[model samples]
Target: MTPYLNLVGRDGIVVLIGAIDMVPRFHSGNLLMRRRSLSASMIGGIVETQELLDFCAHHGILPECELIAMADINEGFGRMERNDAKYRFVIDMATLERK
Candidate 1:
């Protein structure tokens, strides 16, 4: 985040990940006061979730991802272990073969 701070200009938006519960302290006391704000939010409950998905579908929005075969699971894991950003890696388990 230090690199990001250096690049942030006036009124830049900084979004944090939901699982990152702790706040990062900046060495400069006025950093937070420099017209910048941070946001991290948890997903809403079932109805809101359904609504969000519905909205996305209505707008033809979908996640950018690459599908890998179940047989290549180990290869995928190996790539992830190497910090490859080639895939989003999320999958729909319902669509998987039992084998």
Candidate 2:
């Protein structure tokens, strides 16, 4: 998670949600994969979708270029809802480039 946060803070690397599973079921013979969770939160503000889009554009980053990966869970559902509803602040790393 620290690595992900640091990467997001960097100048070139871009991070975005790629995939999501609403209901995941493993087969009897399937093996469970290990994963780590990394998420950040903001306290206030009604972040608009257009503001996020414009921010990404100003930073030379495309939201479509990034990918988010998630599994089937309540947290995942919440994230999907937040993203689809465009309720969080988005930071574009591409804007940190040298002028």
Candidate 3:
């Protein structure tokens, strides 16, 4: 199996797979950038922002932002690896944000 890495941004931690290409989009007069091209293994389980941050810090991976967004097109269906319970949660980065 290929090792997975977390995508970190100013908005938050992005739980996705593959190379993430961030693009600026205009939505209803609001300018926003969405992280795209995320695969299943990239975020097949629950992830905490602190865990991601600590991982990055230990690995020397610098984050460009503090905002995070998760994209699971399958809603986490059929993405289990050997029926592991670790893949049954939706991690919300907002909860881990520093006030």
Candidate 4:
């Protein structure tokens, strides 16, 4: 986040999203001197979420994720342990049907 602050222009804001538990530490002077700000936002409720989904669909925006079969969860864990998994692992529930 410290390095990211440098990338934003003056008065630009950095918005942190999702469930981040740890408090971020950075030099406050970077924000103060540049009139920049940091903010956190929730995804919002069902209706707003649907609107966001619609906007993303209209813009052809998509998330990057790796679909893994339920049977291969152990391998997935191994990949995580070895830091080999580059994308978020989304368990494909339909994969369980074969078993």
Candidate 5:
């Protein structure tokens, strides 16, 4: 989380989603100097999650993503680092059975 502080642009916000057990430690200067903010949100309960999933399914809504084989995970990381991959990467676990 500390590493992410330096990554955001000035006046940027880092929103943490879901549970984080580890106590985060970072310098106040990191936020003060850049006008950054650290915020969090709960994803919601299982029932609410299920309802959202059902709504999307009913509406035929889909997320934009790229499906990659497990073997190409390193390449996927590289793409992400280079900002080449524009969408989320979903690993096709079936590829693991190939070799």
Candidate 6:
């Protein structure tokens, strides 16, 4: 979140986030001033979609991500705020069970 300040401060960069629950603060004026939008989107169950996962497997496509335990969600959110996390957040229950 802090990293976004530089881009949104005066660079007119759109801040696209899926969630803001972990972000501590924000300046709406700064976003509006640059004709930029802080957009939040709901990517409904894309990871759970079997078709998509199969497509990825078929094409050998996978995101560069780190898998963390569900217990580490708080830490995950912290990393997210710092932009340290790449793509993956929490590990699914099925994946956890296998381990």
Q: Which of the two candidates, 4 or 6, achieves a greater lDDT against the reference?
A: 4
Q: How far is candidate 3 from the true structure (C-alpha RMSD, Å)?
A: 16.4
Question: Residue 26 error for model 5, in Å?
Answer: 7.5
Model 1 misplaced regions, further than 4 Å:
1-39, 91-99
- What are the per-model C-alpha RMSD values against the true structure? 7.2, 17.4, 16.4, 8.0, 3.8, 8.4
Q: What 10-residue stretch in candidate 2 is worst by lDDT?
A: 28-37
Mind giving the per-residue lDDT tens digits that candidate 6 earns over 12-90? Answer: 4554456556645777766666666555555447566777789899999988777777677788899877867766575
Off by over 4 Å in 6: 1-54, 94-99
Stretches of model 3 off by over 4 angstroms after superposition: 1-47, 64-99
Error of 6 at 80 (Å): 0.5
Which candidate do you rate higher for TM-score, 1 or 4? Answer: 4
Clashing residue pair totals per candidate (backbone < 3 A): 0, 6, 12, 0, 0, 0
Over the stretch 1-99, how does candidate 3's per-residue lDDT look in tens digits?
112212322233324454456523323212124332322343423456678877999999974432223444244444443333343355455555465
lDDT of each: 0.69, 0.40, 0.40, 0.89, 0.89, 0.65
Off by over 4 Å in 5: 8-13, 18-39
Residue range with the least summed lDDT across 10 consecutive positions in model 4: 80-89
* Candidate 2 residue lDDT tens string, 30-96: 2212232232334234466677767888999854333323233345456655554233334344444
Tens digit of lDDT per residue, candidate 1, span 50-85?
999999999999988867766677787888767664
The TM-scores of all predictions, comma-separated, are: 0.52, 0.23, 0.20, 0.56, 0.66, 0.39
Model 5, 8-63: lDDT tens per residue? Answer: 76787989898889648899999999999988988889999899999999999999
| Winner by TM-score between candidate 6 and candidate 5 | 5
